[model samples]
Target: MVGKCPSCGEWNTYVEEIVRKEPSNRRAMGGLETPKAKPLSLSEIEPGEEERIDMHDEELNRVLGGGLVPGSLVLIGGEPGIGKSTLVLQTVLRMPERKILYISGEESARQLKLRADRLGQISNDCLIVCETSLEQIYVHIKNTNPDLVIIDSIQTISTESLESSPGSVAQVRECSAAILRFAKETHTPVLLIGHINKEGSIAGPKVLEHIVDTVLQFEGDQHYMYRILRSIKNRFGSTAELGIYEMRQDGLRQVSNPSELLLNQDHEGMSGVAIASAIEGVRPFLIETQALVSSAVYGNPQRSATGFDIRRMNMLLAVLEKRVGFKLAQKDVFLNIAGG
Candidate 1:
């Protein structure tokens, strides 16, 4: 094992692996003949809008900066139970005209079927396959010839080309590269669901984010029913877009106006409660903020904040004392975002 990665400059990140090279024809991009280079000036290139496929879900489409682009690679990463699979499956099931191939490396066929039944959307063009091997996945893709492809959790996929285990840095890097080639060659859009590490970044090599055309992050507290989808990187659209969803018994439902759900009208005259307006991307919404100030029981006044930054809370308290002539030195201050 290498002490550090030469490319990424991370310590102890390398793993020894045996690479089995295949024939030229078996490779995704190896069989093509060499072509002469052609240079074009800025004026020579044609400018046109990219063709996008409507996901039929407004919240999802807005986060994607309009719609899904054909032949693009989109990577969605989130916590394990963040409803990544449910969101993708629901979107594909809504489109009955498009031929979609849903490849699950983590869940079984029966499990997906049960979830689909709960979603209550049926599409005859959607194909489900439980596969983990990269070679077998490609074989199925070739035979099916789908317009769109969805891979549920990329960490579970492994390739025979490498000796390393699945989810390894080398394996993820190689497998994603091969899949990207296939998507571009066939002009088919591919959606990859990924797991986030403890640090909240997508699991596997950092290059996985760099390789994809778009990188979306699914975020929300599991306890809370609301879910947020944010676009971190987009090659064909703006990155400052976000989508919100509400988790229900049936499935995830789109939340167009999140402010209405976050605000509590019943707490209008309640003390220590205030309504604050916040904007995410281009959308503005109101959020409820709760503040409690009580006399300190101990020698030191305790300062605590949840869903809101404690440091910011402290700064606010200092402003109140100095600017507003409020003596809060011996008080225990607590702040919280009510709907988190």
Candidate 2:
């Protein structure tokens, strides 16, 4: 009996559509390709550094492994109200020498202007446009000839070729492919802002991540003042690099010394506090670790750790009991890593 799809195992969830192959009237974004491919020897290939544009934000530059690479498609994803737009806008505004095109599908020109005004940095080279149509965006890009292009969000963009709504898997994939092609052909860097799913992944098909050259993830708690920019993937640089910023009223302020900012000076003489040195990439920094030892209030002692590996902590507890001759089996122990 035809009941549910055996593959998906859902009842009445399947729909069929007739897809027609129609000849395109639209001209190719890249003129008809007539060039043949050829193999080059290792000696024939030029050995030089890839050209990059300085983002002017040291933290951002550090995470990017230097700066924005030419003709690169970079995708930045974060949760709502996570300052992804602010970080991008501020970076573009700081680059006064380069012409930047900021296209927003989610916000109006007035709203962006208000944000820019609050940011307190103005550049005559920056142009702002509110549009969602992918074709129209390309037309604007052709006329503007911007050094850099920033789309506020990719999910809000749609192409006329697709009958599906924007943010659908089909629409997201096609629009991203179009943008990627344009960036490569014109040698213009494109920055796309994206939303995160409830599962904390970039909200689109997995192919969206594969299409871009670099993927940056903005992560932090909204209640906290600090945010972390981590490179999830980078084609031209190391992915181990990360950047830190402090969310302020003006804009995102780069945290040059995260160790100093994350450490609490008031806890200097505290018994439970200790400092540990760790290295991320080639950069070395100090992190605070706290441990609390107390008598068990309940019949069973409770062991809790935040930001510290629970398994490792248990191993340490076993060491304390076995090697150190401590009668801590019946006691409660809690460990936490500060500012993690």
Q: RMSD (Cα, Å) of candidate 1? A: 9.6
The residue-by-residue lDDT of candidate 2 on 233-296, one tens digit each, is: 9999889887999999999988888897657878966799988888877677789988998999
- The residue-by-residue lDDT of candidate 1 on 94-184, one tens digit each, is 9999999999998998999999999998888999999998888888887888999999878988888789999999999998998887777
Winning candidate number (lDDT): 2
For model 2, give the RMSD to the true fold: 9.4
- Quantify all predictions' global Cα lDDT against the true fold: 0.88, 0.89
What candidate 2 gets wrong by more than 4 Å, as runs, is: 1-44, 322-325
User: Deviation in angstroms for 124 in model 2?
Assistant: 1.9
In model 1, what are the clashing residue pairs, if there are any?
A: none
